[model samples]
Target: MKDFLTLRLYARVARLGSISAAARECGLSQSQASRIVADLEDGLGARLLSRTTRAVVPTEAGAEFLARAEAILDAIEDARNVVREGEDLQGLVRISMPSTMGYLEVIPRLTGFTELHPALRLQILLEDQRQDLVRDAVDVAIRLGTLSDASATAQKITTIPRVILASRRYLDKAGEPITPADLTHHRIIGGPSGVAAWAFEREGEKVAVDLQPHISVNDNEGAVVAAIAGMGICSTPCRRPRPEMLDGSLVPLLTDWARPPVEVHAYFPLGRQTRIAARSLVAYLKAGFGEPV
Candidate 1:
């Protein structure tokens, strides 16, 4: 157990690239962590890490060892999961997702999950950009669009309905568009990149409208807010604007047209080594989405 804990500490130090931070997570002082690492090097007769005032990074040998150590730790965690299945989950789980999905979908579901595993520690990163999961130490990233050649393993969670929307006031001022082509003359609110083209279909007829946004945001929520303020028409998933549509703050356009659904994917940067807790949360999502849990 002592050796196991020491190995765990070393893995955290390597993963974080900060001895002080790793020590803090493991409930050890900086001096203690430093001494432990030094002792580990002395015992192995190897220079495991290159140390500097700014950062502590693994040497070539340490990098190799870290990969093996992480695999061992993951196996141990898997063993624990086998024994403690459905019990309280311990330790940290880092998750990343778009901000709007976090607020509308994931966060609300978290209460039920955390209540069951009160010992778990969650670090949620809500951003519209894709993160370098290995560098950021993210266990799972729930993405709400096409995978589109991302360098990570992805599981298709479910497809969500999409819509092109605008506020009533905006429509009143700009004059409602009759078809996809009319959008060429209208102000458009776009999200980030790769979404500049919007697709619509009706009665086996399909059209893809290329756009240059009058206003662009990196976040979906921002685009929705822009539309609500009567900035322009925006295309996004239906789940986000459900409440706004009901309350008359936003209106779905092109009722005769059907937009392609947004594909939801749960990305695993560690692939087969993804932590059990992260997988558990994804299973909960599968159940919620009416998929096979």
Candidate 2:
């Protein structure tokens, strides 16, 4: 069990690139954690970590061992869960997701999951960019849109309705666009897709417009913020901005037209090697979204 604890600390160190951070997380002094890791190296007869002025990183041998160590720890947890079928789940689940989705969907719906699995620890990493899940030690990621990577193991969760939106202040000044083509005359505040190739369909007719962005932002939340401030008309997942839209801070534009829904998927970076706690979290999310278990 002591050796297992040491392995857990090492895994955290590699993931965070800091021995001190791992020590803090595991409730140990920096020197004690350092000594444990050194003893682990002595036992294995290999230098697993390389310490630098800024960060402690895994060596080539350490990277190989880290993967095995994670798998071993997961297996031990799985064994324990099998024996304690009715008990709360254990171990840590590191989840990756976009800022908007995390705030609007996952975070709000997580209380029940946490309560049910009180022993389980959840760490959510939020970003708008595609993250290197394996390198970052992410168990699961909630990815939006059609996944470009075929190598990843992905499960379709749900789709979010896409819509054109703008603040009432801007629409009152620029006038509401009655048609999809009318958007060409308006300033388009870009969302994640920086370029404006807005796609819309209505009654068997589809219009694809390629308009340059008036102003751009990398994140969906940032674009929504810009639109709320009357920067320009923006595109986003309808459910995410529902609060602002309901409060009359923003208005849905061109409601007559239909845009393709954004795909929401559970992306497992580690594929079949993903932890049970991670899968359980994904299941909880699916149920919250009204999907069949």
Candidate 3:
């Protein structure tokens, strides 16, 4: 039991890249966590982590050990769940999501899920950056677009529709764009680089627009706010600005040139099937997206 706990501590330190942070997560002091890791290394006769003042990185052996450790943890959780088949679910469910989507879409609807499972504790991490399922120790992740990583299993929750939009006042001042090429002359509000490209397809042809944004933001929520304030045109997922569109704060533009819809997926680490709390949350998300749970 001591060795198992030490192994788990080592895995957390390796995943977070910070011993102090891992110690906090494990409810241990920094010195105690260090001692535990040192004991683990001594028992195995191998140095697992290369520790510096600022960061902790896994050695080759540590990386190999981490893979097996994850499997062992999952198996243990599976066995525990099997033993408690009839009981109410009770555990920490750590979920990761894009900040904008999580705030605007999932956070608003979280109450329904929590009300259903009173014993379940939820830890939601809102980050736009890509997170590793194994390293981050995330039970579930709400992801937009395609799932490229082969190490995670993804279930499509919903298809988020794409739309080009502008504030009515902005369109009245700048003139509504009739074609994708006209966007080159318009002031655009967009994300840094990856989310700025606006592509459209109809029939057999495709039109791609490289937007030169007048207002640049790293988050979709910021870009949407800017567009609603009549700053500039924005091409984004419809889910971000649905309220604005409904209230006429923003108007859909260039409907003839349709942007491809993006898929919203619930991601889990590969290997074992998703467990109780995480699975229930995924079901809630699917239902919240207007699909049957």
33-103 per-residue lDDT for model 1 (tens digits): 98998898899999989989889899999998888887787687677766778898876788999998888
- The TM-score values for the models, in the order shown, are 0.87, 0.91, 0.81
How much lDDT does each candidate structure score?
A: 0.83, 0.85, 0.82
Least well predicted 10-residue stretch by lDDT in candidate 3: 80-89
TM-score of candidate 2 against the unseen true structure: 0.91
User: In model 2, what is the error at residue 234, expressed in angstroms?
Assistant: 0.4
Summed over model 2, clashes come to 0
Ranking of all predicted structures according to TM-score, beginning with the best and ending with the worst = 2, 1, 3
For model 3 the local lDDT of residue 289 reads 80
RMSD of each: 2.9, 2.5, 3.4
lDDT of 2 by residue, 1-293 (tens): 98789889999899889989889988999999999999999999999999999999999999999989988877887877666565698877889899988888889889889999898888898888988777667888899988776546898988888988899999989998898888889999888866468898999999898888898988898998999999899898866447788899899988889998989999887444767777778887987887311
Q: What is the clash tally of candidate 3?
A: 0
lDDT of 1: 0.83
Model 1 TM-score relative to the real fold: 0.87
- Which residue runs does candidate 3 get wrong by more than 4 Å? 1-4, 42-45, 85-87, 179-181, 192-215, 240-243, 255-258, 271-276, 291-293
Q: Clashing residue pairs, candidate 3?
A: none
